[model samples]
Structure formats: structure tokens, C-alpha cells
Target: MKILLSTLAFISLAVLLGLLTGGRLSWLVRNTTALRLAWLAPLALIFQWVFFELPGMDRHDLVFAGHLLTYALILPFIWANRRMPGMPVLAAGLGLNLLVILLNGGMPVDPGLLRAIGRVGVYQDLASRGWSGNAVALTDRTLLPFLGDWLVLPEPFPARGPYSVGDLLIYAGGFWLLAGLTRRPAETEAPLKPA
Candidate 1:
């Protein structure tokens, strides 16, 4: 939630910057129709919620299996939109995240960082209770720890916990994407002559 909100905030800031520079938001909206496989984004979010965040779900392994499925669904959205600004960066971030998650059994969270942010309890519970979800505690045993949520947001940011490199990439990509789109002129449909 915090990550998504932070991403939104960054994108909003980028759009505002665009406007200040004489860029139009309408262009961004209009050009977004070129975003193929867009529907997969929402579906991916739903899968994330259902498989990772839901309560009372059974079979941790099954839920764990679903994590890969979720990423699989979202990959198409990224691939289809690769030509857009910020997409390649976003793809890299997503790839890093997916690789780390797959390697670590889920997205690895540093327990210490979680404590620093005062949000360790739920993750600890999820880890210890055999509850299925995306997020494995960062440990000496954790593979590719750097790819995990290692970038900590200090004071003033909504989330204090460590966010991933991929998270930063995602934020940057989204901001650049919006800003770039805003800089483009909106296409005006040609007026039809009396045919």
C-alpha cells in the first residue's frame, strides 16, 4: 500500500512538473490507449491480494504457487508497454523483483528494517505462522538480499521501511513515463469534410 501510494505521489509530481513546463495531461491520457495488455495490471493486483494478502486462505504452498502466477500475469503488461518511456526501467525493476521473489520464496523483508519502520509484526506473523503470502523475512539464508527491499525511506516519506531497488526503479519509471507522455501534444482528430 505504501509503495503504491508513493509511486502515485511521484507520478503526480511528475505530471505537475509537466504542466508547469507547458505539457498537457490530456496527451498522457490519450496516448495510454496504446498501452496493450493494460487490463492485466488490475488482474495482477487482484491476484496479489487474493494470494498474498487475503485472510483465511488455505495452503501456504498453493498461495506461494500463486505468487509466480501473479507475476506471470503482470509480465505481459510490462512487455506490451515496453516502448513507452520508463517501461524498460520498470521492466528491469519488475524482473529484479520477480527473480528475488522466486529465489527467496517471496519478496524478502529485512526483519530489522521492518522493526525500524514499526511494521514487523504482521510480516513476522506471516513468516512464523505458515501463512502463505509474498514476503519472506530477510535472513542470512535469504538469496539475493540486495534485490529485496533494501532502500529505506527516511523521515517524511510515507513508508519508513526498506523498499526495493525495483521499487525505486518502478517509481522512477512511472514518473518518467508520466512526464514524457505529458510533454507530447495531444492528437486532435481531423474534422470530417462534408462527404
Candidate 2:
């Protein structure tokens, strides 16, 4: 339910911004490639949610798939749009995550944090099913060098929310990229006549 609301809010915000920015929505829609990729995000998001919520499913597998979709597919798509400013930053952030993943074997989840967050049942289930410890654990110590590990972030206010440094970097990169892409390029000024 929260996911759905968040998704709707994102869409609404995008549309509102598009309208305010002289109808970029139509321009984006006219670009078939961009349009297709834009649509794909929501679909991928739905699949991700389903994979995580389905009963008797291996969460590690789903988590891996989610990361693969982002790193392998979505990142490439963003790269293909390299003419857009800020793509480089997004690519760099993705590369960092990819490096961590490669170094740490699959996803890097901290087991202790998972236990703290009431995810022990899910972790136990995945572990029993032969998932790698890095894939299902929930500890900062365990996940730091891994790709998925970068997704977990501890809350700033000491509340009970876990997030990763990678997540922060990703968000910052993504926002920067989006802002760059959405900005209108400056128009060239004609030479001034002699006064």
C-alpha cells in the first residue's frame, strides 16, 4: 500500500513538473525510446514488489533480480541517453555499486540489522534455501563492500530505519542527473550592436 502511494505520488509529481516546464511530458512521450523506458520503470517496480511480497519465495533471488534490473538494464538505458547532462554521475554511482557487488559475491545484506528489523524470518527462510549470507544478512559490517549492501542506510536521527551510504549516493546522483536532464539549455546571445 505504501509502495503504491509512493509510486502514484512520483507519477503525479513528474506530471505536474512536466506541465510547469512547458509540456516536457509530450516531448518525452514523442520520443518512443524514452517513452518505452519510462513506462518500463513502473512495470519493473511492480514486479519487484511482487517478488518481495510473494509467500514461500526466496527473497535473495528477488533482491538479486531487482539489482540486476537496475544495474544491467536501467543503467544501460540511462547511459544510452548520454547526451543528457548528469548521465556521467549516474553511471559513476551505478559503477560503484557494481564494483561492490562484484567484490562481495552477490548482494550484501547485514544479518544483524535484518534481525533487528524483524526480517529474521525472511533471512532464515532464504538462508535455509541456500542463499548466500551476503545476500540475506542485515549488518553494516557484512554489507559494506557488496552491491546490495550499499542499499541499506542507517537512519540519521537514530530512529529505527536502515539505509546505506550507497543509497544516499545513488539518490544524490539520480537527482543531479534528473535536474540536468530537465533543464533547458541556454540560448546563444546575438552580438550587441556598437553603442
Q: Write the per-residue lDDT of candidate 2 for residues 61-158, one digit (tens) a residue.
A: 55666656645556546545544444556566667666666555455565555666655664575456535422544344544554464243354332
The TM-scores of all predictions, comma-separated, are: 0.82, 0.56
In model 2, the Cα lDDT at residue 65 comes to 64
Error of 2 at 152 (Å): 6.1
Error of 1 at 58 (Å): 5.6
Model 1 poorest ten-residue lDDT run? 186-195
- Candidate 1: segments with Cα more than 4 A from true spot: 1-7, 126-132, 185-195
lDDT of candidates 1 onward, in order: 0.72, 0.49
